[model samples]
Target: MKATRLNLAPWLFLAPFLGIFCLFTVWPLLRSFILALQQTYGPGTTEWVGLHNFRYLLTDPLFWTAAANTGRFTLGSLFVQLPIALGLALLLNRPGLRGRGFFRLTFFAPSLVGLPFVAMLFAPILEKRTGLINATLHRLFPIWDPEFAWMQEYVMSSLILAALWMYAGFNMVYFLAALQNVSKDLIEAAEIDGANAWQRFRHVTLPEIAPIAGFVTLLSVIGSFQMFELSYILLNNTAGPENRGLTIMMYLYQSGFVVGDLGYASAIGWVLALTLMGIALFQRWAARRYEER
Candidate 1:
């Protein structure tokens, strides 16, 4: 009875979180999954159509296009943003890096400024003909095309750049936090053993931050899959010229809301959820392996 009492308090504390999780997250996911395997019935008239929606999703050309674009975005962000953020974090994590807090705050500020604001802020800057980037390039390098339509010619690059601007700072903050937690004793010990700066970081800093890095990687992957508000607000929901910036999430919205294909959209949603779950599991496994070593 006394041991039961001891553990009861923890469960009592957990009751709220568990209740909220089931109410908001778990329930919605189950409902969505069920919706995925069924037919599209408006609001209150869902009829049984087992695996039919999934079948259509698998065979649909639009589905393939959205899936491909999502993959490209995820891989592109992983390659371009992660390395740059990590490098910046490493530099800023130095013992006496000047204005560290100021830079950190400045970088992370954009992320906190809301997604809609980011789209509004960058839309004009990426305006095909008169955008600041092209104007500056025209002045500095006359070879650059001042007439380049960002919405058409450089659509993928424009979207990726916007994503980088919005997300790099957040990742930088994550890396910085993880870097700070690295044991100074380990670094000092490595230095005393005549290790070069590169050696110390490669051996100590990287390994210690593996779990955090894994977490950020998973988040980045999931985020890439779920990207919507930015593209919708900025590109006017078209993705761009030839749908270059069209992500899967946007496609889901376009299908459900624009095309009125709720059943198909639910199918797409389930696929996305499965993909995110797989990536998360892989990251968890990788984190465990890194920690074990």
Candidate 2:
């Protein structure tokens, strides 16, 4: 009886969490899967479609466009944003740096600002003639074009830049923490072995921080794939000229809410979920392989 009661106690404590998870997470997930397999006219009407939605998604040009744009943004985040984040973290991690706290705060402050606020903040700054960017460029270089249409013409570039500003510092915090935990003894040993700065980082520091780096990379990729709000607000709630800024999430939003096609939206959502899961599994496998090496 005591053993049974002990077991029951743990379950009793976990009852609230389990109930909430089943109600919110599990039910929603199951419903979405069911919705993906049906054709819905509205919230009330659904027709069994089997695999039709998935088949249609394959031939959907707009879906492909969104996928391509999302891929590009993901690549940009991985290569560009992450490196900049690591560099900033490295710079800030240095000992005897003057005003380290102030610099850290200054860099990280942008990330604290919400996406809508960031969008509004960058709107004018990215504008053409009188905007801060083009105005400064035109002032510095007489030949530079002040009338460049960033939002309309260079949509993805603008989004990437905006993301860089907002997220670089946030990612830096992770790298900074990882850097702080790196072994000073190993670093000093490398130095004493006549290893240069780059060599020391490569041999000792990098290996120590590689796990954190991988985690951060996974987070960045996931975030980039899920990007919507900044692009939506920046492009004025449109997909930008020629659908240049159209992302997978944005497409899902348009389908589910705007176009009133909940079924199709569920299909897209499942695809995204599966893709993220695959990427996560791949990252885990790669990390294990790297650790083995």
The numbered model that scores best in lDDT is 2
Q: lDDT of each prediction vs. the true structure? A: 0.83, 0.93
Q: Considering summed lDDT, which 10 consecutive residues are worst modelled in model 1? A: 37-46
Model 2 residue runs over 4 Å out of place are 1-9
Worst 10 residues of 2 by lDDT: 38-47
Cα deviation at 291, candidate 1, in Å, is 2.3
TM per model?
0.89, 0.96
Query: Model 2 residue 220 lDDT?
Result: 91
**Which clashing pairs does model 1 show?**
none
